[model samples]
Target: MHVVITGANRGIGRALAQGYAQAGEDVTGTARSGDDGPRLDVTDPESCAAFARGLGDRAVDLLVCNAGVYPDKGQNLDTGYPPEMWAEAFATNVTGVFLTVQALLPHLARATAPKIAIISSQMASDSRAPGGSYIYRASKAAALNLGRNLAVDLGPRGIAVGIYHPGWVRTDMGGDAADIGAAEAAKGLMSEFTALSLASTGAFRTWDGQDHPF
Candidate 1:
């Protein structure tokens, strides 16, 4: 399968890219900078369009919207997180995913049983614990809404949409002290991806294939 994964320069995205490429699947991985180079900037629509246009007539079988931002790196939401941070988070985690998917929808339509997967987080769930990273949590919640909306809109067109939380994966984003490694998360996600179907569209699931509460 020909697949496209964003934020492939490091962490879980890099692991996912390697997993697919090593499996002999034709894969296009993007990042801000890297070996194959960055082909996607989540904040830019023109870049996404250009990349989609460059893919020729073959539709991408799977488009994994794994790009995200977290303020936990240097900024904490506790001691006065700027509203601008919320906007930035939504820009990449929410709006960016929407634009990327919208731009690539046509190419996705050309594929047989195409799927669009958004890399979301358990923090998105209101039912789950929500005490930190307000911006990240809110943006992911919005992303999940977008995914559900897309399921409703794209289902008729034969595209399967899903939202996934990769667990506390060990990555730059997840931190080095995280329990699950990026490779493990990628491996688990790949298994779940293969098991997806129309029936599973709009569902929020964990990397191990368990359904997560919306």
Candidate 2:
């Protein structure tokens, strides 16, 4: 199988790319700087388009939308989440995913059972709201909603979409105090991605396979 993963230069994204490559699957890992792999600025429409053109009609069985930003991680409740922070967060965390999918639709259509995996966060859930990191939370929520709707629209074309929380992983973004290691989270997420299908599309699931509350 051929898989394309965004933000794969490090963290959970890197682990996921390694796991798939080790399994003998073809993997294309993209990053914005091009130091790790192909350069892809998910927030830029022109970048996404260029990346798709570079693929040259190659079929992508799995497209993982793992690129995101959590700029408001520890912002003050009163003065935090500035307008620019919100804009940047949504541009990378939400709009980026949509642009990536839109650019790859034709390549995905060439696959037998194409699937899109969105890496949203549990914090996106309304029931899980504890009130901090407003920008990140709202952006993730939008990504989750986008994935669900994409699932509905793409199901008829044999494309499935699954949104997931990749667990509190120990990474640059997730922090050292996080609950799980990147490898473990990547392994579990690969399992979840593998299990995705038209019947189970639009599910908000955890990396460990449990259904997450929307």
Candidate 3:
């Protein structure tokens, strides 16, 4: 399968890209550095659009929206999250995905069964989190909604949109004490993606295939 993965420099995105590439699948992995290719600053619509075009006429079987940032510099709910932080988070985690999907729709349409997967967080779910994550949580929650809405709107186009939580993965973002390793998380995520069908569109799921609440 031909796949496009964002944030490939490190963490879960890097692991997933390596996993697919190791499996002999054609893959395009984007990162901030030119180590793989040019930087994909997700906050820039032009960058996202250009990246989609870079895929050429190849029908992308999967597009993994994995680029994000969690600026947990000195955060606390008691201090209140700033609107600028929220905006920054949304620019990368939500609007970036929207633009990426929009630009790739044409290429994706040519595929037999195109899939769009957004890397979401369990903290995004209102039912899952009692508090914290402030800006990051809000942004991911918006991402979930976008994925679900796309699932409905793009259903007729034969594209499957899935929201995936990779679990508490041990990455730079996840910290050292995270429960799951990047390789294990990547394996589980691939398993879930492989098992996905048109019937499962609009579903929020974990890397292990467990259904999550909206």
Candidate 4:
């Protein structure tokens, strides 16, 4: 199987890439700096288009939209979450996911059972609102919504889209106090991706296979 993962230079993305590589599957891991493989700036339409065009006719069985930003992690409610920050977060977290999917649709169509796994967050849940990190939460929520709608639209084409909350992983973004390691999250996510189908498309789920509250 051929898989394409974004933001694969570090964290959960890197782990996922490694896991798939270890399994002997063809993997293309992209980063903005091109340090890992190709330079894919998900936030830029031109960049996404170029990346897709560079792939030629390669069929991508799995596309993981794992590129995101959490700029408002510890921002103060009163003075933080500046307008620019919100823009940056949404551009990367929400718009970026859409652009990647849009550019890769044709390649995905070439696959037998193409699947899209969007790495959202539990914080995207409206029911789990505890305030703080407004930008991150809102952006992730948008991503989740996008994944759900994409699942509906792409189901007829044999492309299943699953939105996932890849546990609180111990990465630079998740911090050292996070509950799980990147490898654990990657393993669970791979299983979740493998289990995705038209019947289960649009489902908001955790990395561990549990249904997440929307």
Candidate 5:
């Protein structure tokens, strides 16, 4: 399978790339600097378009929209979450995913069974509100909604879309106190991506293959 993953310089994106490559799958892991495979700034429309063009007529069996930002991680709700931070967060986490998907839609359509994996967070869940990090939470929620709608629209075209929480990973972004490692998350996500089909196109799931509340 040919897989395209974004933000693969480090963390879970990197792990997913390594795992897939080891499994003998064709993997294209993209980073902003192009240090990994290709240069893909999901926040920029032209960047995404150029990356797709570089792929030529090759099929993208899987598209993993994993690039994201948590700009207001520790910001206080009373005096934090500035408008600029919100803009940055949405640009990377929300619009970025959409642009990546839009740019690669043709490549995905060329595949026999295309699958789009959107790496969202449990923070996006409206049912589990704890406040703080307003920008990250709101952006993730937007990403989740985007995946849902994309699944509906893309299902008839033989594409499957799934939004998932990669779990609290012990990476630079997740901190040292997280619950899982990048490898473990990648393994589970690989299975989730493998199981994704038109039947469960809009499913919101955890990395461990459990259903996640929207």
Candidate 6:
């Protein structure tokens, strides 16, 4: 399958790309800075359009909207998360996902059964709102909502959209003391991605395939 993964320069994105490639699947891993090439600034509409243009008519069987930002990671409700932080977080974590999917609709249509995996976070769940990291939480919640709606719209076209929390992975964002390594998270997520289908579309799931409470 031809899989397109965004923010693949590092962390879970890079691991997923490497794993998929080793398994003999066609993978296109992209980064924002175009580091070592294939630049895709998901925050910019024209950039997404340009990326799609570069792809031409190539089929994208699985589009992993993995690019995101936790701009207010260390900020607080009081004088920490500024308006710009909220804007940056939402732009990359929420709007960027929409733009990438919008730009890739044509390529996805070419596939027999296309799928979109949105990498959300467990913190997005309303049931587990302990507060703190408000910006990241809100943005992820928006992304979760976006994925659900996309699933509804795309299911008719044989496209499945699954929102996922990749676990507390050890990455630059996840921190060095996180639960698991990026490779481990990638493995579980790959398994989850493989099992996703029209029947399970619009589901909020964990990296290990457990249904996540919305």
Off by over 4 Å in 6: none
lDDT digits (tens) for residues 31-62 of candidate 1: 75445555788888888888778787878899
- Tens-place lDDT per residue, model 4, 121-204, is 999999999999899999999999999999989998999999999999999999999999999999999999999999999999
* lDDT of predicted model 5: 0.95
lDDT, candidate 5, residue 146? Answer: 97
lDDT agreement of model 4 with the native: 0.97
Tens digits of per-residue lDDT for model 2, 65-149: 9998899988998777789999999999999999999999999999999999999999999999888888989999999999999
Question: Which lDDT value does model 3 have at 189?
Answer: 94
What are the per-residue Cα lDDT tens digits for candidate 5 across 1-214?
9999999989999999999999999999999988767999999999999999999999999999999888888898788889999899999999999999999999999999999999999999998798877888899999999999999999989999999999999999999999999999999999999999999999999999999999
Residue-level lDDT tens digits of model 6 in 52-165: 999989999999999988877767567798988889999999999999999999999999989999999999999989989999999999999999999999999999999999
Model 3 lDDT, residue 200, Cα: 94
TM-score of each: 0.94, 0.99, 0.95, 0.99, 0.99, 0.98
Which pairs of residues have clashing backbones in candidate 2? none
Q: Which ten residues in a row have the lowest lDDT in candidate 3?
A: 32-41
Give the higher-TM-score candidate: 2 or 6: 2
Winner on TM-score between 3 and 5 is 5
User: Could you tell me how far off, in angstroms, the CA of residue 191 lies in candidate 3 after the best superposition?
Assistant: 0.6
Q: Across residues 56-156, which tens digit of lDDT does each residue of candidate 3 receive?
A: 78898998999888875459767867788888888988998898888889988989999999999898898977667778888899999999999999999
**In model 3, which regions exceed 4 Å deviation?**
none
lDDT of 2: 0.96
Q: What lDDT score goes with residue 185 in model 5?
A: 98
Better of 1 and 2 by TM-score: 2
Model with the higher TM-score, candidate 1 or 6: 6
